[model samples]
Target chain A: MAGNREFANRRLHSLLGVIPLGIFVIQHLVVNHYATNGVESFNKAANFMGGLPFRIFLETFIIFLPLAYHAIYGIYIAFTAKNNVGRYSYFRNWMFMLQRLTGIITLIFVAWHLWETRIAAARGSDVNFDMMSNILDNPFMVAFYIIGIVSTTFHFANGLWSFAVTWGLTISPRAQRITTYVTMVIFVALSYVGISAILAFV
Target chain B: MAENKNVRFIITRQDNPDSAPYQVEFVLPYRPNMNVISALMEIRRNPVQANGDKTAPITWDMNCLEEVCGACSMVINGKPRQACTALVDQLEQPIRLEPMRTFPVIRDLQVDRSRMFDSLKKVKAWIPIDGTYDLGPGPRMPERKRQWAYELSKCMTCGVCLEACPNVNSSSDYIGPQPLSQVRLFNAHPTGAMNAPERLNAIMGDGGIASCGMSQNCVQSCPKGIPLTTSIAALNRDTTIQSFRNFFGSDR
Candidate 1:
């Protein structure tokens, strides 16, 4: 009954995070990394993705729907979570607090990002190099994007660690410790790509 | 270890459930290889404070002086563990004692662990049998599976895992890790498998398995080294399949 639905919803939240949403973050970062080459290179990559067939359907189903559910449910999970970091202060305990925090930050950042880019494009603005450059022209926007990018990457990377445990991939302490290291590497690598791309716009 | 030397203790004490808690310090003559329970007994014998004031004897809970009973669990020097096994030689001076906050403090160190017991009841952590007639012997589990189940069976309903967990608290009804691990234990039993769906369904609800944030402090905090996180993870898979079956209208 209701219990089964709650379990399924939670599993869906975990799954959607790593599947389409997590993959989308990586893909988005890679596409944005193209800006490191030059304005034209970045535009070409962004346009190619934008011009895919069934683009609306893909955005609605693969991207928007899943993102919507993950974000909404994630916010609930974040607020309801009773963080005992102050008392425990264990490695995983701090990560648990950070996961909730980054979830909230990433949600706000993604909302503003969508308003500036995709929503603007739908309203007859071009999503191009100049558009990104104009957005980063302000120092505050630059700092905001940096924070946003780092937060999003940390959320995704740390999330992968929990995802492995949630799916029963890492059972032993040794296995969990190994994934902690692996996910730390992921956070560092993805943050580099994201921060470098944002700086490139500046 | 001189006989004249003494060990100082700062213990948190509450007169009753309705009263506020306060701290009192006691000085006991040093004894070699003394555990927390034995030191408390010394304090109870004289009922004297560090300042030489005659006071009411400190109250706490204990049954088996061994760690197996789990009744002596309290926060010693900020870590939740069995006071029975907490040797005085190993603990820092001025050893601090506090009741496990995850449960409501009935007096001082004695918490109403009925939360954990209630959870065990909720999950039906037992094999139900008809007493009308004598049933035949139960089916035997493979030796390998039996060994694994034995590891999980070591839980003594101690509140250490819950105390270590950030999720379980007075405000939250997450049921912590103890009962969830018990569900895995009972569900694995051959006779207990009859109610697997019921137990799985119990944990599927709110304040159930989904409440586990995977902070994983439970596994590390378990006194018996029960693989709590592993059991929760296995349940994640089991509940996932159970959800699918429920959705597809499959009886199996």
Candidate 2:
């Protein structure tokens, strides 16, 4: 009985890990839009974000807390999950596997990115609002950013389309079609915003 | 027309997951009122291809022999659906019989579904009744709520949805739509709701709900047409609220 309960707990934890992480991914993409305005603008925006109380709280809770919990728990989920191979023939299955694999890649990318950029701000260096722009100005970073954006966008968009189903917003075939279109639009919009920012630096 | 004699079949066969799958042709005697499953039965009984060559018995899996069990799902023509429900009269030849590639083939059409089963286990997709005592009829459910729960009860673990899902394949750990939907179903039950938190937690884990790159194919392909995406959407909200609870450190 206890064992079953423990098993149940693990399941719910994994389910919870997706949502905040998903929302965080969106929030980060939206925030990255600041980079399009120039390095100074991006840097200034990051710094200015430290000022507001709710923003600070959000950073701590919404941004950092959920992100950390989601990631750590995510790792736990990955290790525990079975190697479910050959269960599907759908192209989406390949993409599904791709989504999970890319998530890990993107997660690592974000950590390195923060270590290089935002964490550097702790040392009281001169504010460069265009620092984000400067990074994109580099070819390697540009490639990394592009790959990151594409993978993140694909992961989120697909996940969001499913999320619509999970949340009961799309209940039937008609609703599913509408939700698919909506998800497609959202993916395009988010991509547009993300790509527009990155292109500004180029 | 006295008779249009040839029963043309286009079958997609794979020897292994990594193998290059190929198509083969077969012809069966046109029997009156034949169904896809019935046609398959004839092919299996004869084990012959269109060229009159005796070959391996065409491989597939079914139990209960009825659509109610959902065990005989496969792609007919171009659609992922239950073969038992596919009537030959309605189908255009050459009829197609392909393994749902969304899964790994154990032989021909039989693919391993341990993953979907494991997902249900991971999410604790069941009510906890070990039978210590009667427990006095358990908990009561309202009629409307019971009706909704009834809809969720239709899942036969067919895995057509997982096969249809873009996220659940050999390369990914995303448990796919059926398990996630089961979580929603069990969580909604009055007796089952006791473990709702645990069910939510399961989906939140690795290859959990986050892994769903929802292409909406599962929703479209489901034979029972279970509102899969709907379950996923509800899970999103439930998990989000769960996150807030975790954030505030509240059990309530």
Candidate number achieving the greatest TM-score relative to the actual structure: 1
Q: For residues A1-202, could you state the per-residue lDDT of candidate 1 as single tens digits? A: 6545666777889999999998999999999999999999999998999899999999998899999999999987887777877767877888999999999999999999999999999999998999999999999999999999999999999999998877777776788889999999999999999999999999
Candidate of highest lDDT: 1
Off by over 4 Å in 2: A1-202, B14-22
Q: Which candidate is the best by DockQ?
A: 1
Can you tell me which runs of candidate 1 are displaced by over 4 Å? A50-57, A119-125, A174-178
- Candidate 1, after superposition: displacement of residue A86 in Å? 4.3
lDDT of 2 by residue, B102-178 (tens): 77777666667667777778889889977777777777888997887788889998878876665565556677888
| CAPRI docking class of candidate 1 | medium
Kindly list the per-residue Cα lDDT of model 1 for residues B69-169, writing each as its tens digit. 88889999989999999999999999999998778888877887888899999888999987789998988887887898999999999899989987786
DockQ of each two-chain model: 0.58, 0.14
- In order of appearance, the predictions have TM-scores of 0.92, 0.63
